[model samples]
Target: MMLTILAIDDSRTIREMLRETLRNAGFDVHVAVDGLDGLEKLHDIAPDVIITDINMPRLDGFGVIEAVRAGTSHAALPILVLTTESAPDLKERARKSGATGWIVKPFDDAKLVSAIKRIAAH
Candidate 1:
């Protein structure tokens, strides 16, 4: 099956990069500019997996994770967070909010794809 993936990031460049990379890898990709927009898209279509960024204008990555986990329909959905913040405290908070995995910024395409496939496999 072609897995549908939702990628949320405030930076248009990162969003497009992820979308293209995943698409070339044979996955269906959808994108949102920020957390709030990502939430709206999540409600409209529950993708197999969600990849998000930590810093955003509307709702940050943690906020998205909280909202997704709080919703009965999406509570169990898998989420991989890609962010620049590598602090242990931030990762802990993300875990507390129910993030599935974390990858620091400037990630290699291969690693990112591997992580996505791993999470989507679940």
Candidate 2:
């Protein structure tokens, strides 16, 4: 089965890059402008994995993760945070919010794809 991905980022460049990269990697990629949009699209896409940015309008990555984990159906969905923030405390916070994985921005395409594959493997 083809894996579908939901990528949420406030940056147009990041969103476009994710769309191209994930699509080229043989995954169906759906994008949202921010955490709220991502949550809204969650039901529609029912994505296998989610890649999100930490700092955004409305809701942030942590909020998204918490929201997703709040529900039984999507509590275990794999969520990978892709952000420029590399602070240790932030990483710990993300983990606490139930993120499956984290990726620093300006990420290597191969590594990003690999992380997604690893998380989605379950």
**Residue 77 in candidate 2, Cα distance off native in Å:** 0.2
Show where candidate 2 strays beyond 4 Å: none
lDDT per residue as tens, model 1, 16-85:
8888888998989999999999999997877999999999998999999999999999999999999989
Model 1 regions lying over 4 Å from their true place: none
lDDT digits (tens) for residues 2-24 of candidate 2: 89999999999999999999888
Question: Using TM-score as the measure, which candidate wins?
Answer: 2
For this target, which candidate reaches the highest lDDT against the unseen true structure?
Answer: 2
After the best TM-score superposition of candidate 1, give how far the Cα of residue 15 lies from its true spot, in angstroms.
0.7
Model 2 error, position 104 (Å): 0.4
lDDT of 1 at 19: 83
**Each prediction's TM-score versus the true structure:** 0.96, 0.98
